[model samples]
Target: MGERLAGAEKEVLVEIVRFTQKNGLKGAEGGWKDFLARNDKKFGASVSDPKKRTKDVLLAFLVTFSKDFQKYFRKLVRRHAERRAIEQYMNEFSGRISPEQKLVQLTTEHLDYRKNYYFPSYQEGWKVMRIGKVSSSMNSGAMLAIDCEMVLCHDGTEAVVRVCVVDNKLEVKLDTLVNPLKAVADYRTHITGVSKKDLEGVTCSLVDIQKSLKKILAKGKILVGHSLYRDLYALKFDYSRVIDTAYIFKYANLPTTSTASLNSLCKSVCGYSVREDGEPHNCLKDAEAAMNLVTAKLKHGFNDPIEIAENSVPEPDQMKLLAHRIPVYLPCQELLKIFSGNPSIDEKIDSRIRGEFYSTCISFNDIDEADKAFDELDGQETKDSSGRLQKSVLLKRDNGDVAGFFVRKMVYGSRLSNSEVLKKRPQPTENTEQKKEDANGDNRKRQRTSKKHAKKAKAPVVE
Candidate 1:
């Protein structure tokens, strides 16, 4: 019923369709221009009005072809399935089916997905399970998933209060409350579900828990979790051979700097949601959720474990300078005023304000000087002329390459005396002659000579 395309036009249309399929819609515009350039002879007559014949015609063809392609693809899938079924029937009639083949067949049938889905081979799976230790006696079927909960300590730092570990079958291997070394400042009841009452009678020491964990996480076990870095950091444990679901589903379309949350990944990839229903989080449940998400990925054709190194925050070197506890509202000029006496020092200030929180980064000239200043002024709080308390503290950089002192307040204590601070310039060496030559050129002479003019001096005195 529609107008028919010419032979040459149809050929070009096929090429265009192939290109679109290979590169998607984003590359279609440039691909069409390239197609025209390559097949200029065929489109010679319509060169002047290329848009009408190329883009316009190709767009219409694509709209029609897309529907047809879907149907064609579905038909191909149906044919493939029918072929596979026929082969299975032939094998059954011949009575030559192997036990391994039968197991695979049964597994595929239960999952209702193609057997080709990317899942680790049996050997690979076992290898992932036994990652850290070296022992021939380790079980090949073992797998681990871990999660931790923290409570606020008296000094406002987070300390691990609860930890949970689960196996491949989602069986709880370990779940225990930890007695923190410091006094509990906040139970974090809403999120951690741990209250003062729960911790009051808790007797599990951190050392005992760590020893128990080391045994369960023995060699040849694959560890799975979401954002495992935070959990490991809280535990102060170092581990390799991990599958982080967050890293697994880190989409190329999203910003490279950010990773998707486990809740979002589970809902999007596994068709299920977690951390909902307004209930307090249980570490065991969270660990199970991570394991389940990985299983879903396996069923959908993700085979390799997303192994990542333990992301340990490196301690800053002694030469590094860090400043913290600065008020966010302080301007750059006012911040620089803190070290105005040290003209030899150069500095840069970075500031950001988000609602009530203010953050600032101040970089200093040299690490040694910055270190000196940090030690002298770190914890000492002072008051301004207006009687407002001014607080500033020195911080340590996680990355030494980014040299600076971070501060939250602009106020600093009195400037260091000249005796306390190091001089920027070095003292001259013992070579006096070389020093004199270096300071003043050889041809330059000092123009200081006392002239004997007694009579002229007397005349001046009379005046």
Candidate 2:
């Protein structure tokens, strides 16, 4: 935000300045205090020192003489933003000393294992070692892009077999094969290039590499990689600082929440790809590729290397049916009772997962059966153990406050089966009273027509 907060700062300040000019300082000050209170947890933690607001403070900011205060506010917002997003927070010039403002900064705090670690946090082996990835003393803007290759362990887990690290200058800092403590289940030689021969006399272990990485990543040094969290997990370090190129660049054609591959990003963003076709995975080239991607993004003024302004990514298109408004406590057997008499419904139901709500994909024999079931089920609420107004199944939620269960109709590409037991709805029969009324109406119309004809014949001829 240091470089990008130019127009955005004024865009926000204008609203405050205008509100103040319209309603005086009291309104502005009250609004400011309210905003600070609302975002205290998110923004307050970023500030190293806290201070109270004064009349002098407003005057200094409005008069543009508080350069120190302005810088502090910029850093505060930037630091807070770094926690919220990674795209704009990380930017760097290749082979040149990056300015403090443009450097990619990360929180000094350690990340919990719930996200990156494949196993549970309480597991004893989650952390590679007791040493933290970053310390308070190191505040350098340097980065080390890394890549790790893995092999299957006897315990049915992946272990790091090869590790590679490259500096911002594309210089290889460390590249070596490791002898995993566990017996190798599969060398995955075609990909990792580590065979039985590769580890023949390998002396270094993961612990040795961990000690070496502690020195390399120590002192607040930021790490860079493509999907670096996976590498961090393989290495078993909860490294706090990282700039992942997967989240930084855009291919524009992929899922919006998803990202492009390292090779794809490298080719599109840097006008070149590190690994060529038919080549096995190379960690050194991959590390260099990731660094090149970040520097390219930096060159483009922190914008995506390609034209991403079009927002050409299409929305997901698919039909989903569901029985909604059912409480979590509703058992699968009780819920199935609702679809009992409707022979249209298939017997398969998925109610295994439970939370605040419970629902299963109610498969119908055909589209007609599905539509018939939907008409009866939509907006019907399923009650809990206590008898209440809980009725039938549903598809969509009429209220934003409500949650809905989405049953995918076309799962994969399987076609819906035709049910031989389809029961056709009976046709409507004509009513006897309707027939009697039609005869009576015909007689009345005939009598009126006859009277009119007789009058015309007798009197209208003389005229």
Candidate 3:
């Protein structure tokens, strides 16, 4: 009822409301002063005098528009909140969406109820939210293969001296020598080919390496390597998303304690040999080898290597030998009689005598024939003189290869004869006792000599 704002006045008034909403009037010591100072040129003579504008025109406009300004600000905030809710809902349901569905159904069809009225298709929604791109200026969370080289530190613990990271395409992304925090005890030149000279000018610290790795490796990235746990432990990293080649090529026939060697797995599964150049292990080469194995595995759909190996069908002469264990007390004639019953038992099974154990290496025409004999002979019981049960058990090799059987006596663990047991037991000797006394005497004498030398060395010498 007082006076309507002119066109220019209205525009200036709207700008003031927006500025006040963005930077609130409360606790804003010079907020009004700043606003006036900034817009004085734009408003010209109308707002040139701060007191006249505030008392005559601004006070009335502020009283009227304060309510409308709050409403306008709240609407903007609501719109922003709605967009965030929509983004969160889309991300939560992204994995659950079926391929054929064109649009994803929201939890509530009433957009106002859920506060996210703008529900788009999965693809379009992701585009709107910029979901695929990371805000960080680092590498994306792509699969990476990594390997590390270690040297024995002065404390006799292995420390990472070199680290290498490669992408899925076999491109080397990071390869650098890391200077150890402690003095190196051993160069481990035979394995790592790293010597003291190589680290003479090295300046990269472990923290620096960690920072670089963090830049390249993002969260949820799958790290590929052979024995990645050891490398991660050496790096002091706790990342858990990993694909270990050792685990993927774990020997199926053997116990979980056994794992295939990276070199062997590469040769057996990928039909290529790695680290055979006799040079120290190259981390980049190792990373590439691991990546190649993973690629081959993916291409072949991860078929079992045991099935493939057995299908090749090796010749009788080319068949691998199997090792078995037998009771040491079993007489040679009795052992011959036991094996004579089985037609598959090769005539030339090799035997070796150890403490309380007799090991036999058996060969067969093929793996299938050997497995058949093992199934029949394994767990078979034989009767001793006292009518006690002595069961024969097959032995599994470190690579999950089962080749030999051992006789297990129920009452006594081993079948060693009394004479064999007596011979194997440790016997004290006078010479051993004398040697200990001599060592003590020599240590005392050396200590006395060192003390005497120390005193003499400490004596002041005149210049």
Candidate 4:
């Protein structure tokens, strides 16, 4: 029994070693097989029982195979293989998830939602996501700030991208010239100082950059320079959790501020010295500046750390305008028009309609917070030209209150066209008489005050 066990153990080791040696033997491969054959007799009798001996031999065969071709196996199971598996899983899961389920997930997991985060309209509801505050002690989700610098290609139509990511420190994600499929006009000289020679051997397609960006975005949410709208417009990413420094600056109410020039903000908030280089744009540097701005705000007050003024209430006129544009939540129309030249209307409403309607109505107040909601709504109206729908709208304001109003499809189109009703009014609602009286009165008083100011400027009176 002892001899058999020793023989079996020796067989296993020999098989492992022989397998490891076979591939390395090159054209003169007889050395590995010859060595294995010489040792086989010693292990063949290691197991006395016929069945046990065959079983041991089989195991040894597998072990030998693995050891001999371990390099090939390792190559097959690299990161690329793992990524293929991940993509397959994502494709299957995406196909299985229903639209309702996607909506629920977006609301409960994907958004930057606080406990009482408001939604002003049903359309804006999609942007809502449940977000939990992360504690520093627990290292779980990490936020990354990314900036991409682009250059114009010689073809007058592509951009070279230099991407940087900021987690705690700055790191380069990608540095390459991307071929933007559009024309590269002379205006590109302002951003990318790339001459024709510089673009040689350094050009890649927008598709290549987009594929790379998709991989990068898949990893995490990226804070971008304030003008994220333009960047995202260029790249195809439903950019997740993007905190635009431009939007932040606007929300934080910083005057004479822009993300393009980082020096002013850096000096005020992060105390970092940054010098501009005339080389092709460095996106990584921009991403770092954006991250630093946010970090400073999170560490200190918005003003002291980010060099922005404290949050001040908007003027009354501005507040009134915001209140006007807040989305009115409405139920999904039962009969969605498909434009097949025939209308199929479903009059039998779902039993849950009332509950769903109420829930959506609650979100309308939340949509009111965004000042630019109207402009966005205009875009949506253009996209969804079904022209058969119900829109919850702010009613004519009377007695210092905006009432609820519902305009059917045809009515909305007419209302939109009527200059008298849709005129850009300075105030929400005022009688024509009141407007005329103010215009006449203020004009005379302003003219007299201007004359007096001019007279005073010409001759200084001695007191």
Candidate 5:
């Protein structure tokens, strides 16, 4: 059986080692020194106080013996003791029961797994709906990012949580306290940093925090977060639409082979240096940092192109253009009518009426048929009088149906001059006048040849 120590015990061991190493000791000699001194004061007292003395001596002897064993046979003894505990715990488990209420057992098992694993469970029935696929599908709308912080506290202990939202939406919600949920509070007089008083006035229940978070996140529209699975699991929210920044970053080839945490991603991509002024693991700061990360990279570019925008593109004009020309999943078809060329519709059209067009075939009853016919043709990308590539496409379709598909070739986000980089379709070298003269000469030669043939046929007939 596998044996696992609790985080508190691991921390105790870590602290002991850290103290010993800093003081240049083989083991935890520093704490042992204090232990010895405290024991001497209690045990080496008058014989009249024999009860206290005996207890103190016993404790001192145990400490000394443990230290000696640690020096001589460190890992072996620890492992053996751990294995014994593991076996005892495993043996004490009750046998599983197949209950009449099957759903009850399933839910109990589900909750147990989530709590034990400290992560969300993927229970969808689709073959492709695995953990990774669920993560991607839910987070696809991560556009309109938001950066924020969440403060978490328990048992008079406090910590900060940083959060980043992509597309201002959440797939999974989380309300977990950091530094392991059950860490001992070190309210030290020597170190006047974190204290009970500091976290006193602002203390609130987990549920209260969750409610507040819900309000704050109402604007997110969609959520994109890092290790969001764990957070959502903790929050008890079955958030299915969250885009895991960790997953997206890795897929984008951002040098993150392992589970990409926010801190790691920030340091590598944006040269972000985490400050120690605030508590090390503030959720809000982390979230803000994440939002900044995607937007900055998107507005700019990535190491390669893999760092796709966690949210939809934010340019309003671009969005409007997309809304007008492409399918934006909206109901209104205003922009669609603008593109169709109807001379009668032109009279109703306001010259200064600047609004986006949409793709809807339904004619508006209030507007005349000519006016309301969803302009499906003749709308061309408006060009400047001088004929430079002005933010839109130029009209070139032979059928006057700008509505139909056409090949578009332009260097996107290119720095090269238009004339230099954009190779126009090869123009005919010969002048139009010369081309016409050549065509006329060819027609005359064809006519003369036909006449000669006719004359030869007549001579044959006469013979």
Candidate 6:
């Protein structure tokens, strides 16, 4: 296992496949099923419901991860692998987990949540696990289009808010709002057509949607959508055969690398608009538009039309917002008092995470200013309830813990975005030692010159 960890390719799943005769090695006595049984204790959960261990129950836990999540996971894995060099052991149960269940295990875990969020799931979703699958199965005639709308999560990532599926026959199969496992960051009502009230009692999970799509697309089925890769990614399902209308149809005077929007294709090719300007998107309409676009393409013998016109792409998010987690109950009124008593939070003293230190989080209109106030309040000398300044206050995370969480843990408060921006902000280069030496040399020269002038004036007076 150590040798495999040290190998050039550290992908664990690939090594499993290499043991088979398909990879030119003599076949192992039992294949993956036998291997899974032998290594059950490594990859499987320490305590799982016996009923959920059945093959039919496998679909319940399958998840696809965001690129950010995958990146973080690989980084953590690399860190653990380095620790192994110094005799640290990998988690005994890390291997027991099946590939399908790797996602959302972070539901309650941190640092281990590499299979999770950041930058939303719209971009960077389906670059891999496609053409390879297509090459294997060259003759699957079935195709269906899928689309998803997402809202931001509290942790600064995207979660699917709605999903829609439409078949080639212009029939709607599935269209429903999803309940994000994480808290909503932004409903994006202007674009997603999803409001907080829309998802109030929505009990649909990502797994449920994935299972529904899997049922629609059994195996080797062609999945279609405008930017279908992202839909698959947001759904966290991996299917190989896909028809991306965004790619199949092209806009005039545009590069192939750039994709045409479903709205644009519908307007120019299908002679319609999915939605009007400044209107929220309808995924069912969008999905059906994609299906229609594909149908038109098939009618045109899969060739992009010469009369293809251009349409504008959706604008990227411009709000560079950030938040800080306060381990203690620092109320909005207290925060405003700290921020020069200004209504910095727009008098919007609201919180989804409430009543506790760990659950309490805040963001400021001005980060540096808010952080300044936060540090002062969370500092040693803070005003008491009676408006008296108290020194020697206990630290926020000072729960009399046995050891520190990180090597360089925070003694004071810090904002998530503030710390990140500080890391990226360049420090001014200074030669302090050189400046000191120059100053000292100038001082010595001045002293010597003053002494000579005084001595000469005194001698002349004496003469």
TM-score of each: 0.38, 0.45, 0.40, 0.34, 0.27, 0.41
RMSD (Å) of each candidate, 1 decimal: 26.8, 19.6, 31.0, 26.5, 29.3, 20.0
lDDT by residue (204-253, candidate 3, tens digit) is 97777777766666543556788676786677654433566665542333
Q: Which is superior by TM-score, 1 or 3?
A: 3
Give candidate 4's TM-score. 0.34
Where does candidate 6 have its weakest 10-residue lDDT segment? 402-411
lDDT of 1 by residue, 297-363 (tens): 6666544322111121111222233233344433334444444224132233221223333344444
lDDT of 5 by residue, 1-463 (tens): 0122122133333323323323334323334344445556753322222222333342333234344434322332243344344334334532321111111122223322222222222223111111122222222333433333333344663333323333323232443332223443553423223334444444444445446456544522344455555555444444332334544432232111123346546665666643343334544455666555655554554434333232211122111111113222222332333343332211122111123332222222233332322222323333222232212322323344333211111111222255633353244569989899889998997877787675643211100
Ten-residue region with minimum lDDT total, candidate 2:
310-319
Return the number of clashes found in candidate 2.
2
Residue-level lDDT tens digits of model 2 in 318-377: 112344445554443444333423433322322222345544445544555544544454
The residue-by-residue lDDT of candidate 4 on 80-165, one tens digit each, is: 23334333543566655332222222322312221112111122112222122212111223446665555554574334344446
TM-score of 1: 0.38
Give the Cα lDDT of each candidate.
0.49, 0.51, 0.51, 0.38, 0.35, 0.47
Best by TM-score: 2
Candidate 5 Cα errors over 4 Å, as ranges = 1-195, 216-220, 251-257, 276-279, 300-463
Compute the lDDT of residue 28 as modeled in candidate 6.
34
Off by over 4 Å in 4: 1-140, 150-162, 181-183, 249-261, 276-281, 301-463
